[model samples]
Target: MTTLRRPEIGSTPEPLDLSFPAMPDRLGEVRRQLREWLSRCGIGADRAYDVVLAVSEACSNSVEHGYRHGGGLVRLSGVVTATQLLIKVTDHGEWKSRDEPSDPRRGRGLQLMAALVSDAVVTSDADGTEVEFRIPLDPRLSS
Candidate 1:
């Protein structure tokens, strides 16, 4: 088993933390709960939805590829700055990038993530895979 360590962001970031079993059926609930959490915390609805979508994509990838639908853990954490919301999803599995025409169409999650979030980062090494997404959390949220 591999252990993944989550680095601490800067102090200017507000942290919202959550963890869930890597199950397909639970993904929707995760998104919904995150949405509510952000809303109650005074995050803008638009930015919250963007974060939810990006997180959903990342978690889905974990369920479909990281754990291969068997079982694993997905950790979702958010760091909100005055102008950005940084979300990180860590999975206890390795990432295998595909690069062939015949490659299973199973690798577009990152593409979708890139399109939905302001910034998307994937770090996969000996420890595990961690994907981070950022959403602008400017004064719009406090409006």
Candidate 2:
């Protein structure tokens, strides 16, 4: 279940947290909602679009491959500050490696996210997989 939070802007950035079941159908709505949030945070259209793509890809990977059986939780937490947009997507399930195939598009989400965000980190352990992205805030870049 996802929590409803009213993210606040102040001297210190207030983080917004949300969680949902690892279901394919829900990823799109969450991604769209996050993109809208980025815009509301004063991010540029291009940047927000890139963010949305990266986040969507990460979330998709979690929902589709994070567990071997049964569903788990996919959590998203974000904080928008005057100088940066920090976002994290975490899944509380076993991480499984994707088998290689002929198609190049099957396993390029991490690469794309690294290209889009200023800084990103992906870690997986026995507990879960966590992907964090930090995008530098540029005031004049917003549309």
Every model's TM-score:
0.77, 0.80
Q: Which ten residues in a row have the lowest lDDT in candidate 1?
A: 1-10
* Candidate 1 local lDDT, 66-118, one digit each (tens): 88737878888876555655678899876555653535755677877887774
Best by TM-score: 2
Q: Report clash pairs, candidate 2.
A: none
Model 1, residue 62: distance off in Å is: 1.2
**lDDT of each residue in 41-104, candidate 2, tens digit only:** 7565666778888888888888877855888889998987666777999998876665534366
How far in Å is the alpha carbon of 104 misplaced in model 1? 5.9
- The whole-model lDDT of each prediction reads 0.69, 0.74
Model 1: residues >4 Å from true position, as ranges? 1-14, 100-106
| Cα error of candidate 2 at position 123, Å | 0.8
RMSD (Å) of each candidate, 1 decimal: 7.5, 6.0
Measured on C-alpha atoms, candidate 1 has an lDDT of 0.69
